[model samples]
Target chain A: MTGQSTVLAADVPFPPSVEDFYLPSIVPWGGHDSYWFTKITALLWISVALIIIFFLVTYRKPKLVPTKKQWIAESIYGFVRNNIAVDMLGKRGINFAPYLTTLFVFILIMNFWAIVPFAQISPNSHIAFPAVLAVISYVMFIYIGMKHHGGLKYFKHALIPPAPWFILPLLIPIEFFSTFIVRPFSLAVRLFANMFAGHMLLLVFTLGGFAMLNANVWFAPFSVVSWAMTIALTFLEFLVICLQAYVFTVLTASYVQGALADEH
Target chain B: MGMTAVAYLIAGMLVWGGIGLLVDHWVGTKGIFAGIGAVVGIGGGVYLIVRRLGA
Candidate 1:
């Protein structure tokens, strides 16, 4: 430790460090504790409210001709409904469009918050949000499986699969652990890791660019190049934001489909 | 999606292997149970992934 000489870093503007990619808190309290109105928390609430407002404004009055706002809303709904739900679940998916659509849009908006001006960090970059979403999906599929297949039968179908009875014992634990435990855990980890990585990449290029600006006169031009990379990555983040949302929604639909199906 | 499969596979091994270690402690055995648990976990994980995700 450079002791007294060491500087206050990243989250501060004066000197940039890689740690700037994380450890910023708009709220004074611990996130795991009560009274945590951190930046991520606010963004999560705002994302939900904005999405509600978006839909309300667009479809407040149904129009035959359709205004531009209505068209945008319809397209978003149709895209998720047709492309994700219907495509994965077939005709059986028609009833699920609303649920899947809302899930898709919510995840998209929360993730896209990372690139927004004042809200440069995504809430899903944190593990808790993803975990909650994943758990909801897990419980949903489990409920569907149980309801459709019957209580004991659902466990039988899930644990035994279509395999022969001789090997059922070995497969039971594997299936139980993977389906019950791993599904939600992996779902959460996947979303959290992607958002976390994307944010880090942006922080790296943007802050590195600014820091390089004063590294030396000769290195100053490279700072511009770094800033350019940051801009490029921002656009990439847009694709990632949409893609992750779509992927999550599709997987959830697929899980539902699997539960309803006669066989795996 | 591919990464999820990988995570599942790795998670299975770690999770089951931990269980095996606990069992080993309870039974006062060596690493035998843990090794078997790990291999079984890996095999089961790969089998499930391929069945679910393979085209």
Candidate 2:
């Protein structure tokens, strides 16, 4: 929140800087050292709570004709169910609709938090959170393949593509890393980098604009331009946030599809 | 083979190449081991992609 970072007195040689924007405190309240209760942790829980509350309110009672709440809920569910899971996995994907929907919405909210006023940072900007999400997707992708095919068959299918035995030494490690390790690593990095970069961009403009305003009368116009850029970037960030969420959901579904397929 | 396969290839080379560099550091053999690891990684990655996706 720029509250602590805004203090910049000329008396002190070390004034507020941009790195201060990312509140990397181990503990929120001054207490024991802990990873718990960080801003990102709160954001993650808020996202989960919002999703649960959304569905809970929407489907509390059975209705022949749906209300606005039901309509919104159904639309979200339908989009993931039909557009993502169904499209990727066909009839077999029906069982995965709920999981995909949860994933899409969770990511959407986490990303959306960056642009939200007062809550300017996104939890996904941190690697740890994205890493966990990626691990979940990675495990599921591998697990589905393993379940569909036997364990031995699944690894064979994943590791050994239709290639000559002579190339095995070259192919095996690449396949192992790319197919198994890369999936989760890339997923986490992609999300973390986007969110991290977005937050930094916003911080620069917002803080630069403020710094300019406080510095001199001649710099006021440039301050206005900085603020304008910040506003414009907010809209672009909104689109990106939604898009990233959709991309994550779609890729997850496709991974499942790949896993379930008879062969690559 | 696919974007995913390509990603795998890059990841493979990066990871193995990194390990090779680490080993080189341990052995103090300059970039020799890293070069070997990188070449093997490229071949393996390409082979993996080709086998699964073909061509």
Candidate 3:
């Protein structure tokens, strides 16, 4: 009674707060201040844990006749083996199928987190994640190249391609720059920047709706339109998510193939 | 971005690239070109940073 207002308040305004909108981290670890970090990291780890658990459980008891889970696992394995490895790297590439498949599925799951509710962030949107992945692929390919060809031969193959001598100066430097520097950087940055910008755009529209809702009674109706756009964008993000993952895996296979081949 | 931030970013990228090159070499791949590329990236990064900061 003592704390009662002098006049009864009917329309209590919701104070503008920072909590409602999501702002992506521009640098790695920048999001630790917000829910974005916890949500995205937890979801990513959970995806990894689930993949491991699924494979372990499904393959723990192998059989000549497959169970439902076994069939699903085999299908996924075969899909990458046949489609990505064999198609890109040829028959010898079958051996790389498992690693490439793991990379694809893991990245796909991380990318999918962008569209998932509550989490609403892609881990790969952070440059560090993609950079780490690119490094792994870079290392793998280099290892494969050396393992296949001898020490000096790999360098000779990578730089000195089967081309005319006149173009050697231009091509060698260009090839060298592209294969070593541009390839991995572009691989990482492309995925990170795309996902990051996509998520940021989604955030802007979605939060704009909420911000508008607080403006006036007339503004309330426009929120639905904003939401509709958000939904459409969400669908587009899904396509991008899958496409980026595929591109990453495909590029990895191609790099490995290039490394293994006699010709550059 | 601030000059320091730009500098740090360039340095980080170069260091990472160098690390990548060294790893490739250690793994037994002929990574001489890769190492050169890393050095070039570092130089490019420094040049870009210098130009931006100078402006």
lDDT of each candidate versus the true structure: 0.80, 0.80, 0.73
- Cα lDDT tens digits, model 2, A136-191, are 99999999999999887999887776767886666666667777877888788888
The native-contact fractions of the candidates, in order shown, are 0.21, 0.89, 0.00
User: What are the runs in model 3 whose C-alpha is more than 4 Å off?
Assistant: A1-37, A216-218, B1-55
Ranking by DockQ: 2, 1, 3
Candidate 3 lDDT, A1-264, residue by residue in tens: 112221221232233233423445534556565544555567778999989999999999989999999999898888889999999788887899999999988998899989999778888877888999999999899888988898768877776655567645534553465567776887798889988888877877776666556656787678789778999999999999999998889888988987897741
Instruction: Give the range where candidate 3 chain A is weakest over 10 consecutive residues by summed lDDT.
Output: A1-10
| Runs of candidate 2 exceeding 4 Å displacement | A1-35, B15-47
**Of models 2 and 3, which has the larger TM-score?**
2
What is the total number of backbone clashes in candidate 2?
Answer: 4
In model 1, the clashing pairs are none
lDDT of 1 at A208: 75
Query: Over all chains combined, what TM-score does candidate 1 have?
Result: 0.81
Instruction: Please write out the lDDT profile of model 1 over residues A141-223, one tens digit for every residue.
Output: 98988999988788777766555677555556767776777778777888888999898888888777756665556776787
What is candidate 2's lDDT per residue for B1-55, written digit by digit as tens? 2567778678768867987999999999999989988877766666655656664
Q: Tell me the lDDT of candidate 2.
A: 0.80
